[model samples]
Target chain A: GAGVSQSPSNKVTEKGKDVELRCDPISGHTALYWYRQRLGQGLEFLIYFQGNSAPDKSGLPSDRFSAERTGESVSTLTIQRTQQEDSAVYLCASSFSVFSTYEQYFGPGTRLTVT
Target chain B: AQTVTQSQPEMSVQEAETVTLSCTYDTSENNYYLFWYKQPPSRQMILVIRQEAYKQQNATENRFSVNFQKAAKSFSLKISDSQLGDTAMYFCASTLQGAQKLVFGQGTRLTINP
Candidate 1:
């Protein structure tokens, strides 16, 4: 089976620009998550969607960061007015549901660079 | 809220040798799950093993095993007969039962030397 896939494997943008990263979860997955991994750091949870509704958005760093999932399949993370601080690898993961027992399958992450 | 910590930032072991990576977590919830994930240079996160809070027996997958100490809140991963392919960043994560988000630890980079 195909694993979670993210589009635009690499992106370079100037500061103050906006960018959108896309994620395609597994066929039947109902839960999707977004995380940010800065260089030499751990994964930081950003937001998650359970069947198109985000139940936890507490991890979003600021108002400039937002994510949305539609049809319970594909998700998009948007960063408005990108800052150099936003530069990092954006990872997407999906699982069968929100259950802790289920394993989350991750994608090859899209590396975003802000200059 | 849940918090995970990996005391060791890096580890190196000779091929075919045994190695262990330590991880500790703090959480108020009694029912939860613990996981170990490996991220290679390709930046792909792969599930190495998982342990359920209620399960006393450690989880093992071939050469990878976890010593889960529920009472101490410590979950350590042991890799027996380490292989060069095992070289990567290992992260420990925990989440409450029925929770959607996971709290991750600062990864430990493991290197398998020949």
Candidate 2:
């Protein structure tokens, strides 16, 4: 089976521009997550969606970061007015459910460089 | 708040040797899950192993095993007969039961030389 997939493996944009990163989870995965990995840093949780429940946006660093997911399919993370600090590898992960026992499968990630 | 810590920033060992990566965590929740994820040069995060806080017995997956110490709040991953393919960044993470997000550590870079 295909694992999670992220589009635009690499993206470069101006500091003041806006960028949208896409993620396609496994066929039946009901939970999806987004995380940011700064250079030489660990993964930082951004947001996640579980089935029909409300998405958890607490991890969003600022109001400029937002994400949307319809049902259990695809998810898009949009960054408005990107800053140089926003440059990092954005990763997406998914699991069968939100249970801790279910392992999360990760995508290759999209590296965003804000110039 | 929950926090995970990986003390060793880097580790190196010869192929077929044994290496252990240390991780410590602090959390208020009594029941949680600990995980070890490996990120290769390709930047794909792979699950290495996982341990439940309530399980006193360590978790093992072939050459990959974990030393879970609930009282001490420590979870260490031991890779026996390490192979070159095991070289990657190992991240220790924890999350509450049924939680949506995982708290990760700084990660340890493990290099297996042939």
Candidate 3:
């Protein structure tokens, strides 16, 4: 329970359906990140949230992909009209707010399977 | 853009022995961080070790240590006295200054044989 927690350990969804993955980062961690790991591929950056700083949206793959965080706690990645190729393990990580370190604590990612 | 590469796709080591996993990266910045993460069957991504690019001394944590070659841009992880519990997927990652994006390698599948 102390580590970052993700909901729906596994999700099977129909193509063109909407799917929302929830991530509950460790308490007091100001920086939260979203990453996607496709089968046989490395993790790809998605979105980031820092306390009060504008969320970095550069890593977002497309306009259809969006995320939001409520007061630096629970964050959700919403995939609208999910496609089959969108299947992957979505990972969420959080780190203490430090200017010089990038050591992030990760969660057991949610495995999404779009059929 | 920075990228991490793990050349060894799969590695095997005898129980109680030592093995090293190789990782390389391409970066222009002088200051950054390199990390090795382990994902076991439980699927929890655990930080094995971390190294700051500017530090010359190697970072060590119990049985895990890292060999960092700054000029060569290589960061390798060495696991000593490997146990069955050490079998897992190991990922090498890098991140830059003033950013939260972590670039990761494809990961190496490690197995410890008894």
Candidate 4:
């Protein structure tokens, strides 16, 4: 079975530039999530989508960060005006459902560097 | 606000040995779930094991098991018969009912020596 997949395993861009990271969740998955992991740090929640509805966006660091998922399948996270502080690994995950018992399968992640 | 804590920054274990990783979390919600995830060099977050707060018995999966203590808000992962492939960054996460928002710990870097 195909697992959750993310594109552009690594990316380097200048400061103030905008970047888009793509994710392809497993088929039949109705829940997608985005998270950030900075160097030597833990994973920070970014946003979550459940069946086209994102119930939680509070974890997004700033307005420059946004994400969208179409038809509970593909998802993209956009970071506008990237800053040096934004250098980190952007992780994408999807689950069978948003229920308590469901397990999340993570993608390889996109390592974004704002140089 | 809920927060997960992993006090151990790094740990090491010889092959065939056993090791334990400590984790503690704070949440006001009565019902929630705790998870131990492994991230190897590949950087994919894999679920090693999970435990529901409502269940008293610990959860075990092959070589990976967790000691879940609801009252203490502690969930520790114990790896038995450690193998070289077990080396990675282990993160502890918690999510409360309906929130689905995961709070992750700082993570513990575990090294398995051959």
Candidate 5:
């Protein structure tokens, strides 16, 4: 079975630039999540989608951060006017359902660098 | 809000020896799930083991096992016969029974020495 996959494994952008990170969840997965991991830090919850709708967006750091999922398959995280503080690894995960019993499979992640 | 903590920032163990990583969490929810995830230098997060808060028995996966203390709010991972492949950053996470979000602890970097 295919695991969750993310695009643009590595990205370097100047401050104030905008970037988009993509994620492809496993087939049939209805739940998708996004997280941010700063260097040597723990994972910070971002946003999650159950099907194509997002139920939790409180984790978004600010208005510049947003995410969307379409067709209940692929998701995109967009950071507008990125700041150096936004530099980190963006991770994507997917699960069969929203239940806690189900394990979320993670993707390799996209390492975003803001210069 | 739920919070997870990893007291140890780093640890090391000789190959074929045993090592233990400690984790604690604070949550008001009674029903939840606990997990241990490993991330290697490649930056791939892998599920090591999981424990259900409602279960009394600890969860074990071959050489990896967890001592889950629900009363003390402690969940520790024990690796026996540690291998070099086990060298990585270990994170402890938890989520409510019906919740979709997880609260993760500061990772513990485990180094396996030969």
Candidate 6:
């Protein structure tokens, strides 16, 4: 079975620029999530989508960060006016469902460097 | 708010030996799930093991196992017969029942030596 996949394994951008990270979840997955991981740090939750319900944006650090998932397939995380502080690895994960028992399969991640 | 803590920043184990990584969490929620995820140099998070808060019996998967202590809010992962391929960063995470988001701990880097 195909696992989760992310595009632009590495991205370098200038401060204040906007970047979009893409994620393709495994087939049939109904839940997708985005997280950020700074160097040598833990993962920080960004946003989550379950089916067609309103995405959970509670973890979005600021309004500049947003994500959208079309139906139950692909998800894109957009960071508008990116700051140097936003430099980190953006990870995407998906599970069969939103249940706690279901394990989320992660992507390779996109390392965004804001210079 | 739920929080996870991994005390050890790094650890090492010889091949065929056993090693245990400690993890603790803080949360008022009674029912939740605990997980251990391994991230190799390739940077993909892989599920190592998982434990349900309500389950009294610990969870074990082949050479990987977990010691779940609900009262202490502790979940430790024990790897037996560690292999070189086991070298990676291990993260402890927790999520409330029916929740889609996971709270993760600062990972512990485990190196398996031959």
Fraction of native contacts, model 1: 0.94
Q: Report the lDDT tens digits of candidate 2 across residue range B39-83.
A: 999999999899989888999999999999898999999999999
**TM for chain B in all models?**
0.99, 0.98, 0.98, 0.98, 0.99, 0.98
- lDDT digits (tens) for residues B1-114 of candidate 4: 899999999999899999999999999889899999999999999999999888889999999999888889899999999999999999999988766667899999999999
Displacement of residue B5 (Cα, Å) in model 3 is 0.7
RMSD to native, candidate 5: 0.8
Better of 4 and 5 by DockQ: 5
Interface RMSD for candidates 1 onward, in order: 0.6, 0.7, 1.7, 1.0, 0.6, 0.6
lDDT of each: 0.94, 0.96, 0.91, 0.92, 0.95, 0.96
Model 6 chain B poorest 10 in a row by lDDT: B46-55
Q: Native contacts retained per candidate?
A: 0.94, 0.82, 0.66, 0.70, 0.92, 0.98
Candidate 2 per-residue C-alpha lDDT over A1-115 given as tens digits, one digit per residue, 9 for 90 to 100: 9999999999999999999999999999999999999988899999999999999999999999999999999999999999999999999999999888899999999999999
The residue-by-residue lDDT of candidate 6 on A1-115, one tens digit each, is 9999999999999999999999999999999999999999999999999999999899999999999999999999999999999999999999999888899999999999999
Q: Where is model 1 chain B poorest over a 10-residue stretch in terms of lDDT?
A: B95-104
Write the residue-wise lDDT of candidate 3 on A1-115 in tens digits. 5989999899999999999999999998999999999887778989889987789889888888999998878999999999989999999999887343856888899999999
Which scores better on TM-score, 3 or 5?
Answer: 5
Q: 1 or 3, which is superior by DockQ? A: 1
Give the clashing residue pairs of candidate 6, or none. none
lDDT of 3 by residue, B1-114 (tens): 899999999999899999999999999998899989998977788989988887999999999999999999999999999999999999999988776788999999999999
| Native contacts present in candidate 5, fraction | 0.92
- Candidate 1 stretches greater than 4 Å from native: none
Clashing pairs in 2: none
Candidate closest to the true structure, highest DockQ? 6
TM-score of each: 0.98, 0.98, 0.97, 0.98, 0.98, 0.98
Q: Across residues B23-95, which tens digit of lDDT does each residue of candidate 1 receive? A: 9999988899999999999999999999999999999999999999998999999999999999999999999
Docking verdict class for candidate 6: high
The sequence of per-residue lDDT tens digits that candidate 6 reaches over residues B1-114 is 999999999999899999999999999999999999999999999998888898999999999999898999999999999999999999999999999899999999999999
Can you tell me which runs of candidate 4 are displaced by over 4 Å? none
lDDT of 5 by residue, B1-114 (tens): 899999999999999999999999999889999999999998989999999999999999999999999999999999999999999999999999998888999999999999
CA lDDT for candidate 1: 0.94
